[model samples]
Target: MNRKSIAVDMDEVLADTFKKIVKTANDICNLSLSEVDVKGNRIWDFINKEQAKELRKAINTPGFFRDLEVIDSAVFAVKELSKHYDIYIATAAMEAPNSFHDKYEWLMEHFPFLDPRYFIFCGNKKVVHADYLIDDTVSQLDAFTGEGILFKANHNENTVTNHIQVDSWNEVLTLFSSLRVV
Candidate 1:
């Protein structure tokens, strides 16, 4: 029997992008920001207009996406899930065209178990064909046709959502495990 498929997002879901973004924003903007400072809000909303503008350019810079730290246990959890479901890396790379290559390279280095053909780089995630989508963005969840699992991120702490929310990879594993049993 064919296994169900899951489309996993790359940014805040599997990658610690906010951590890198905060560091980049601080280095270039000469500001001291921490997870506490940006909690429950977007970095752009938390910082001043000038800082946001600079951050926008800095993030768009080539190599920004190359060395981002992976989310804790993301590799192990995704690998476990892959045993039961076809895993696909779905990223909104069109927003930053420069991230396409870097993100691909990063995935290749980190998630070598996943086939490169499963990597998706696109603007609208609504086009993704899968049984489930694990993402941190509400818009993407809303667009997805299947079950949406919202991976908790600092910016989405207070987000009101009907979809299931997982605070960590362990939670994600537990949730999927339950789904498999059902």
Candidate 2:
């Protein structure tokens, strides 16, 4: 089989984005958002819209993304996977054009391994066709027709679904390797 084209989500998959957002929110609002509960393959719940708004504001704070930290296993996993497959960072950015540009630039600066061809900032990811998609949102997974892997998050519930669920980047790498063999 040919090398598969993989589209991976940026937030929880590549960076400690959700955690940072939560931390930022706490710092700004003095409110604690519950930890995400990721079960089986679904998110049991998520931060409410009000909290989400606060998190978004935090992300918009000056130099927020610039100082953001990449997830522990993301860089290594992407480097390893890139040797065998085309890895694309497909992210759902803020609706605002300026915010999107800032986020995209931040990603580019932080992850030099990510090429322009592999960086996509879009409002929706379901339409961006790829052989496999690794994402954190179940709704996005539901929109995709091809293989979708749910990168497990704190509030996920192990609900039966067509998508595969993996907790860590290493497991994601292993899953892809197995798929390549078959």
Structural similarity to truth (TM-score) of each candidate: 0.96, 0.80
lDDT of 1 by residue, 15-84 (tens): 9999999888888888798988989998787678888888888888899999999999999999999999
Best by TM-score: 1
Q: In order, what lDDT does every prediction score?
A: 0.92, 0.72
Q: Given candidate 1, what's the lDDT at residue 31? A: 79
The alpha-carbon root-mean-square deviation between model 1 and the true structure, to one decimal in Å, is 1.2
How many residue pairs in model 1 have overlapping backbones?
Answer: 0
For residues 54-85, could you state the per-residue lDDT of candidate 2 as single tens digits? 66666666566555678778888888888888
Highest-scoring model, lDDT: 1
